[model samples]
Target: MHRTAPRLARILACAAVPVMLVASGCSSDSDGKPKAEKSQKSEKTDKAGSSGGAALATPESEKKPAVAPVKFTKLPEACRSLKPKTIEKLVPSTKAKAGTPGRSTDLLTRGSCSWNGLDDNGVKGSQYRWLDVSFLRFESDAALGTSGKQRAQEAYTKEVAKNRATTGAKNVKAAPSAGVGEEATALSYQLRKTGEDFSYVTIVTRTDNILITLTYNGTGYAGAKPPAVADLLKDAVPAVKETVTSVTAANK
Candidate 1:
């Protein structure tokens, strides 16, 4: 009986050893605080990705308001009558040539006028005339130089500056005009008023002394209520520049 009692005591001690080890492991952290851990990189990556996605989701409609179309009408006889004098004032040096009256695609009855004379820089010049009474629009100058291409550029620059000053243009920038063919170059200054009107003056020159100055001006139409004239000028300037550039290229 004594031998059996000793063996049973050994067996009980062996079973209690495992329970003690498990209890010690579970209760090791007596302060009840969670283990400190390093920050996860995946969380930062996810945040950065979400921010970038948000930045790219902006819509185009929010960037700019739509512009309204322009309402147009025929120029009254009084308006048409002033055209000759106005053209003379606008281009004083050139001699007026006879013009043909006609209808244009933009819904204006236009009278064409032309002239030949020396440019501001003393270059020989010739110009085509276009006067639209309804919009009070005129484009009547085409010029070339006896001085040289560089002189032509200088003359045109001066002319553009003078026109801008005369018209009280605001928010102006130099831009490309339409090319005539492949070689003729063109450029212009676009002008706009914040809420009033749009207009532009373009200067196109070739390697030859040919310099062409074109001025465009207009108010807004019905469904397309004219934006601030200034904003329209801003938009029109660049467009006219592109057209002049193309024309230059074509002329080449």
Candidate 2:
């Protein structure tokens, strides 16, 4: 009875070992698999959340404001800006009735035209006249952050300063004039060249984003009297008015 009882107890112990092992295996499969799946899901969610947050952190400057538009985009033809009649009266006996167009790679931004003539009058003398007009247009720049009219004003100031500092110019006088454009300045001076005294008058005016600089100069030959400042300005002021008027017409 003692040996049988000991064998039976060994068998029961072996059977209980298998039962515990089965229970442990089932627990590992259920709990370990769920934990692994949950951990993987958590890692994936963390990665997705981090990626979404990175997308929303853009700088404010990346959405810059739009630049203001310019008023004038097209420049008129340099030679045709003035009327033929106006040209004849300003520069009498001009060889080039159509005026000479200044060289320019881009006509949309800057352009110029000039007319010169010598009206001969027998032994009394010859009247020499030269007239030229230049147009400069400014456009709003987004990178530079400057408006077109502001740029034009800067250019106008520079032009006036430059004319004031002409080399060998005498009796330089600058005066603000009305009825020409938004603002007009007449710069007058005397310059002697080629053994003759020349009277020069320059009218610099700015209209919106455009600048019109008109210069009229004359000298007498064969002992004739040089033109007076009044004479130079009489034509210069009107010519500038006409040129300024043309700017409005060109836009229309």
Considering every candidate listed, which one attains the maximal lDDT? 2
**Model 2 agreement with the true structure over 1-252: per-residue lDDT tens digits:** 989999999999999998998876765555566556678888999999999988987766765655678888888887888888989998999989999999998898989999999999989999999999999999997777788998999999999999999999999999998888998899999999998899999999999899999999999999888899889899889888888878888888
Relative to the true structure, how large is the alpha-carbon lDDT of every model? 0.40, 0.90
Residue pairs clashing in model 2 are: none
lDDT of 1 by residue, 126-218 (tens): 222222211122222223212343443465566545554555556555544444311322223334465634444333322233333334343
Measured by TM-score, the strongest candidate is 2
RMSD in Å for candidate 1, one decimal?
Answer: 20.4
* Runs in model 1 lying further than 4 Å from the true structure: 1-150, 164-166, 176-196, 199-207, 221-223, 227-252
- For all predicted structures, in order, the TM-scores are 0.28, 0.77
Worst 10 residues of 1 by lDDT: 128-137
Q: What's the alpha carbon RMSD for model 2?
A: 5.8
Candidate 1 at 26: error in angstroms?
99
TM for candidate 1 is 0.28
Q: In model 2, how large is the Cα lDDT of residue 147?
A: 84
